[model samples]
Target: MAKLRLFVDRLSQPSRAIIIFCLANGLDAEENLVDLGKGEHRKPEYKAINPMGQVPAVDDDGFYLFESHAILRYLASAYPNVKEHWYPVDVKKRAQIECILDWHHTNLRRGSAGLVMNRVIAPALGHPLDPKAASECEALVKASLDTINTLWLNEDGSFLKGSSEPSIADLSLACEVTQLQFLGEETKAKILSPYPKVRNWLDAVEKATSPHFESAHEKLRTLAAIFEQRRESQSSEQPAAQSDL
Candidate 1:
């Protein structure tokens, strides 16, 4: 069997999920870093691999696959020897997981991506933050959290689908929501405070996928630290500037 080649930028939530899945399952894959910052994904070479030029693409020998969720489902189906909980064989259970993955794209993923792009990526790209857009995205995120807390999570279990074990859906949603951790503490709290279930689910997911989860998110953690330091510097300088004035 050809070793799967994963083209990814860990900073991407979906990419991180794929990385965690592959590592957690012990899939035979080689990591191919595509630096979005360097526009590596946009180059002609990579565009040929995935015209959409997204991270979390996979090449199994010559067979190419894109879209993180698709890749995840393919991996789970192809590698049946993996733990059953990740992608169960039972028809209803598998369907439920699929349902969550489908809902994820338009709901949780949309808001999370928007929040991160507006709050973090936009600033890095030298674009001013759009207050309206940020607010709207924040609302979407909160709404998604409400639904997840009230509906998706099981009353008896720690993961989605009411399974004691984590699944692909858990990894996907967890990665999506944790994007908020990149924001300042106050901003993060504002977005996360009302949803204790979401917070607890995140903690459970982190515990279930640990080490690998933490490893895949190193870049995000670093970015959060940098943002915190920058904010602190600006805050300290504000008083000095005011004193001089």
Candidate 2:
């Protein structure tokens, strides 16, 4: 039997989510890194796997899949070993999880991804930082966090939608929050400070997911360290440049 082939770039939140899911479920999956920075995802060979040319596509034997959410649902349904809490068999429970998943794309993901792109990625790609755009994104992000704190986060449980265990929705959103590691520590704290419940829920998800969660984020952690170092170097150089003026 061919192992599930997972093509991913760990720096991507969704990719990390998929990796963590597979590892946590103990699926026999082969991880194939697709370097988005080098445009490997756009190559014809990779396109043959996913026409959209995106990282985090999967080939489970001959069946191919793209989009992290779809892939997660498929894997949970396909593999009998996957625990029910991750995506329950019960209709009501599943539907509740589905609702959160749907809301995530337009709300949490939009704000978080937009902020990361504007504040971190755009500048790395040689584009000037857009403070106005980033500020807009930050507002949306805070709104989304408030919603999660007040709505989705259950008082009865540690997970989303009142579930006692972590689900696919939990993993997805938790991974999205982890992307804020790219931001300056102070900036990240300011964004999260108002929502202590959201922060606690994130910690619960991490604890539930355990070693796999941390392992999957190893690349992100490494890159974040480098990003911080680079930011400090640039800041130090700025004063010297101004002094010479």
Which candidate ranks first by lDDT, i.e. highest?
2
How many angstroms is residue 68 displaced in model 2 relative to the true structure, after the best TM-score fit? 0.6
lDDT of 1 by residue, 1-245 (tens): 53789999988899999999988888888999999878899899998899998897999888899999899888988886678899888999999999999999988899888877776668676788676786688788889989899898847799986789999999999988878877766677777888888888888998887788888888888888787777677768785541211
Model 2, CA-based lDDT: 0.88
Stretches > 4 Å off in candidate 2: 239-245
Give TM per candidate: 0.92, 0.93
RMSD of each: 3.3, 2.9
For every model shown, the clashing-pair count is 0, 0
The 10-residue segment with the lowest total lDDT in model 1: 236-245
lDDT of each: 0.85, 0.88
Worst ten-residue run, lDDT, model 2? 236-245
Position 220, candidate 2: lDDT: 85
